[model samples]
Target: MKVAMWSGPRNLSTAMMYSFAQRADFAVLDEPFYGPYLRLTGLDHPMRSEVLGDRRKDAIEVEQSLMDPVPDGKPHAYHKHMCQHMIDGIPRSFMAECVNVFLIRHPARVVASFAKGYPDLTADDIGFDAQAELFDHVRSLGQTPVVIDSADIRDDPEGMLRGLCETIGLEFDPAMLSWPVGPKPYDGVWAPHWYTSLHATTGFAGPEGPLPDLNGHLAELVARTMPAYRALETKKISQSMKL
Candidate 1:
């Protein structure tokens, strides 16, 4: 099965990618469209040139590759995708061939965490709107996509993952709980800029502390993103499990 795990920046998307990568049957692809996103938006992110230089700058090419057979004959392909990367002109037909999953984090936490690295963040940058759109689009096709919050996964990795596997018709693998503390061969070229904190961990970190105080544009961005976040939250898989 091809699983497209969609999330915005500063979420546990990378950690989830790591978890899935630990499974021997899964071949993981990290942010295959990130380069095209940067090129399309002209966002001057850290290592922008390097990102655009390393990965294909065509969204259609990336989508075609994603729909192709899983490399090395792996049974499953887990593609870590940023929701905001699905810009205008990118065809959504390929989504029908994949088991789509949305990975969300609280808007306040997402804004606070994302702002540290990207001070000029906007509502579009957080991806709440895009995620909701994707969720609805997939649902319109009569497919109930899975939605998993970062907190839920961190709080109970095994239980949440088991539920996720069952929902997607895959057997749960115990190996998804942890991985070696370092970058993987599949990480995007922009990892050095965004994966420093993730590289220092072997498993999901504990719950975060209080949300940071926001003001000005950051606070406004959070407000703008909350409605979309709430829309997706309604479909989030409950993390209540006795493990």
Candidate 2:
């Protein structure tokens, strides 16, 4: 099975990828379309030149790679994707072929963590809008995309993971609970710029504290994203569910 897990930046996405990668049967791909998105948008992202050098900037080629055979004959493939990368030029056709799962985080937490890295950030830059659009698109295709909240996972990793695995028709594996510190072989070339904090941990962090205290622009950004966030939040797997 090819599992396409989608989310925006600063949403515990890397840690989720690490969790899945610990499984013997899963092959992981990190931010497959990042280079293409950077190339097409001409956005002045940090490490842009290095990212372009690591992966082909052609959208079609990147799409083809995602559809290719799972590496090393692994039984499943876990694709860690950033919703913002699905700009005009990137293709979404292959999503129908994979089990698409939307991973969401509260907008306040996203903005709090994100603002430190990108001061000029906009609402679209964080991907809440794009994620909602893609979630609807998946449903339009007659597919029920699974939605999981990062906060829930951190609160109860084992239970939430088991629930997620069952929902996606995969068995729960204890190995998914943790992975070694530092980068894995499949990490994208841009890991240094974005994944610095990820390297310091071996597992998901504990449940988050009260939402960050944001004022002014960050607060406005979170407010702008709440509708989209609540729309998806309502569909997330029940927190009380005892899987």
Candidate 3:
């Protein structure tokens, strides 16, 4: 199936893609937007200097490059990119045949993760406000993108996986619950944080491990995002009933 996993940074977007790609039939495409987002935002990220090192002559060139045609071959392209704001330039038609999923975390947990792991990020830099805005935008657009909680997925992979499969009109595959963990080519830019948890374990495996602790900043972010997140969650739940 053609699928696009939409998310903000630091969520388990990459790891979830890994879980899906482990199945024999799926061919995965790593974040197709990393290069584009970098070009568009022009801010320095963790590996920003290296990723953008002399690749494009200028920002304009970078934008042009992303606007170019998508390279062919992969059937199941899992885009691991940020979606803080809408790019009216890109169309729903671009993803017409694909499944779109918005991976999310409790804003508090999400903010806490960014604060601890990526101290360089500020609230705006982490895009918490913007990401929340996108949830509202999706609702306004009337699209039923599957909204998966990063915490829920980490805690109960099987249940979340089954619900996700059912929502997308796909058959459940037990294999998605667990797989041999290691590095693969399509790993995200923030693989270090993700790989540590996602590396060795297979499947959702239930919340056997300690969860990340949220701090004040995370708490603040959660307070800001909860209403919208809950609304979207309910919208998704209602849609699932029809599907």
Candidate 4:
């Protein structure tokens, strides 16, 4: 199984990756696009190198490389990509084999975290619009992509994770709950805010402060993304009714 999990910023994406990695049969790859996006856009992100280090190849080179083909014959390969939007001028077929999951958080929470992590950025600067684009793009690909809510995952990890495994045709594994908590190599370069849950287990629980309240900016983002987010929710509910 080639699995690709997508999520907005500040979601428990990294922890979810850790969950999958706990399975002895699965090999995981953290955001392959982190490097390519930074290198391609030349954005001066705080953890620029950390995100893109493993993929420091030129952007055009990446475009060319992806155009070739994804190799077949891999089993239990889980690739986690924090995708907000599709890269322009790249082939969607490049990722045809992936079983897609979209992990989402409330915009209020997402914006609050963004504010804390980036002093210079406002909610306007964050790519909320890109998220809808991702929703539409993924919907166009598969019949039923698993859309899991981050809050639900955090609140009831066992049930949500068990259902997630069943949806993806994997046997439920309780071991995912107790994965060693710490930053692994594939973790985002800026692991502080993003990897907070992981670092908490390593004697750094002080950073697990209250979730910041949403400000005007985050409110705006929620309004913008609500339609797409609700659509995904409705789809999930409808699927569950049939099952």
Q: Tens digits of per-residue lDDT for model 2 on 50-129?
A: 88898874999888888889889998999999999999989999999999999999999999888888889999799999
**Residue-wise lDDT of candidate 4 within 1-243, one digit each (tens)?**
767787766667777788887777777766656676665566777766666765676555644544444334335767676565345643456456668777776666666766676755543345445555666776787646777877666656777787788887888988787666566765656675466656656221122346555556566666776666666665451224221
Candidate 3, clashing residue pairs? 108-218, 157-204, 177-203, 178-202, 178-203, 179-202
Two-way lDDT contest, 2 vs 3, winner: 2
Which residue runs does candidate 3 get wrong by more than 4 Å?
Answer: 53-75, 85-93, 124-142, 189-197, 208-219, 236-243
TM-scores for candidates 1 onward, in order? 0.96, 0.98, 0.73, 0.79
lDDT of 4: 0.63
Which pairs clash in model 2? Answer: none
Best by TM-score: 2
Model 2, TM vs. native: 0.98
Query: What ranking emerges by TM-score with the best candidate at the front?
Result: 2, 1, 4, 3
Stretch of 10 with least lDDT, candidate 1: 234-243
Between which residue pairs do clashes occur in model 1? none
Candidate 1: count of backbone clashes, pairs at least 3 residues apart or interchain: 0
Q: Number of backbone collisions per candidate, in order?
A: 0, 0, 6, 1
Q: State the RMSD for candidate 3.
A: 4.4
- Candidate 3 residue lDDT tens string, 57-80: 443443443344443543344455
lDDT of 1: 0.88
User: TM-score for model 1?
Assistant: 0.96
CA lDDT of 145 in candidate 3?
64
State the weakest 10-residue window (summed lDDT) of model 2: 234-243
